[model samples]
Target: MKKIYLSFLLFHYCVLLFAQTPPAQTWYQNSDGINTSVKERWNEDENGFKHGKYIRYDIASNQIKDVYFVKEVGNYSHGKKQGEWIGYTCCNYREESSIISYQGNFLNDKKTGIWKEFIQQDFLHGTNIYQEGTYVNNVREGEWKNTMGVMLGDGTVRTYAEASTRKGFKTIYRNGEAINAYDDKGIDLIENDKQENLNKTIETEFNNCYSIENYKNFRAKYPNSDFDSEATIRINKLESEKQKLILAKSEEDEYLNPLLQKWDSMPDTSKTVTFFKDYYKEFPNGYRKDDVKKRTDIIWNYYDEIKSKYEREGEDIGILNAFFQRYPNITTPSLDEWLESKIEKNASVYKSQIESLISKNTDESLKLALSKLDVINRCNRLLHNSYSLIFSIQHSLLNWKLGNTELALKEINIHKNDIVDFSSGKEKYSSVFKKYYKEYKLGYPNEKEVWKQILLIINQ
Candidate 1:
């Protein structure tokens, strides 16, 4: 009798626990109790003790997106949500036909789980049928792929991209490597094949110029050929070059003499950008420095005037050609200039702020600087919108460096969506942000006072 009583008690407790536990509610089911005029069907469970299928609704469209049905309910003849439920984006009852669809199980008046949907069958899914769908929470989820090849907007069959993602990257396999797919942008590249067709263009140019005796005769024989205009232009450039050739040796000598002398006197690696830029200015079209064309921007960045002038011009092609062929050293001067300016600005702000804090109190200064530094640190931690990240990081770094790490970190954390992880689980940030963080941490005794030790390690 005692054993039977104990067993009975255990069974009763289990039953009570199961009965008290509530079913999971779909995100759509959490609506407030008011139904709009356009709402086709709106029902909420009124029974104080009801548990299964608590709410059901239909809007302008007969399309069902959300439903709550519990299979456990043996019978509620009045209903356990049997009919289709529709949804719509209502403009005060306009009843837009473009309603999103949802199909699935519902329990206890809440979407208990998975739901399928149909978005307009706009694009092809790689060898798969496409339809739109969503999960219970109304979050966009589901593959529209079917088993047959279908063409995308570009007239090629591709594994369509997720609606929320960029289409440039296409899935080639279930996991790992993806094949490169071009969108409309890829269509434009087809014209680039014109370069390969230039043979006829070149032949026509040669005949018109008559640079080669035989080709000139050939053009004379075919006077009305389609390529006459092109041939004429090539002929003109060649004649101009032939006339200019007489001055080439003298001009070449003038350009190369100074550089040759300087290069001989300087050490190979010690030959700085400053030395090269001065050489170029002295010999504007020099041939000798063309060999050491790699170091020109080092000097260019140091000279704000020249760098600024190039940027103000805003002619990238001109800038590239001017520096690359004869002065390859200056090719990336713009980038160098940008980096230098940022560093100077940041350094100046940090120095002035820290100095002011020291005048008031050493601890206050340290705290302010630390906070600014942390902000910079956090901003660098983000990957979205590089410019935004740069500003955010700079703001935080300035605050942390000025002695307010707490506030800086707090502000930067607002961009939580920007954080990402690499395959190695390490964070990748903008180079400038990384550089500043490393410097700031090393500049003082941080929480762990590891900067000094790190410096020693670096030196050793």
Candidate 2:
């Protein structure tokens, strides 16, 4: 199995390596040569002085992306911090981490202007604590505000933020003089020493705060404070993390519930146009897509079958009708109209052949005419269950010509009840009978009297 490795490395190769460092760990030392969470990658002059773009971050594990982010980014002008700097929190806990935390400005290695830290989230779900204030020559000055509350996320810099439960501590400063200090709750901590001795523990494991200045101020105000200070002040935000939860599925449920299983279980013969069309709608991609490519074969396979039948037997209305019923849109020809035209053509062919036979009749000619008439009658009955009176009568005449009186009677018996209603003056076939009778009388001058016997047997 190929393992995905965390990609990050401190490489300098006239180097423009996209995105990340190698999976191997490399420690980043703080200003005091102590391994702090901060790591740095920046351009430096020939004398090893930081210059050009500078970036640093603490690496964390991300399930969605396996890459090292260049977190704290700023510019360095010849070994001196310059321009804007943004710091990000890191190290994979709970398979995720906050993308950004703090952004501030630096001028000649000194923190200046406004600075804000965003994420208060840690290794577990937690609250948000943020700091926004001004720094003059590396000294916290002007109106500095530290808020302990909650906020989601936004872009680069903001003049204000909305937190759900916001409690801000503000101190107004003028010419290096701390004039007033007040929190949102109006807690007068300035000149009020009551909270100085409050819940204080320097034990790093409790993971309380993440501000060095905050803890240092605590230690200064209350020297006897037993509060923790193992840089957990800076690490406390990591306590709140987002854990990726996945519900394990049973093997049977996992395998059988997919659409793929449904498709596999379907019979190949049952894979009709309607079935495959619905399957395409269900699974528009992947294996279904590959199967759709086989659609040409499937569609042509069916059309080819119909074509073969059409070639062998020549236009079976029953087969064409059944085909049109199943697949109406497969062919460009309107099958309904096409079938109607074919039936009319067949009917006309039968009419012409029957009319031509009236001129000269033989046992062989009558036999062939009867065969075609029987097929035409069968097709009409199969399609609409309606009797073609002329075809039926033609069948009887053929049998009468062959001297098969009983079969002639058998042939006319089935249409007996409907024959009168079928051949009534109101029916379309009545005219056909009249036209055929006018010509038919010339061929068999005894056809009228013979038709009388035919009629007698049909009614019987």
User: Which candidate achieves the best lDDT against the true structure?
Assistant: 2
In candidate 2, what are the lDDT values of residues 117-236, reduced to their tens digit?
A: 666444443325466778888766777665652121211121224333464766666544555555676655453432432342334323454455565555665565455344444434
TM-score of each model, in listed order? 0.19, 0.31
Maximum-TM-score candidate? 2
Candidate 2 deviant stretches above 4 angstroms: 1-345, 358-360, 382-387, 400-406, 419-456
Clashes of each: 52, 33
Candidate 1 per-residue lDDT over residues 1-460, each given as its tens digit = 6534533453454344336444343324334674322211222355533334332233333355432222122212134543233331221112122222334554544443444433333212111112222334323233222222223333444443342233332212111121222232343221222333455765655545546454455558657666655556666776677777646646767766667577667553344455555556765655455564644544444445444645686532223223322333332455445544543345446546654554454555556655554333332322134433544555655555455556555654554335333334534344444565665552432534433432333233
Distance from true location, Cα of 128 in model 2, Å: 28
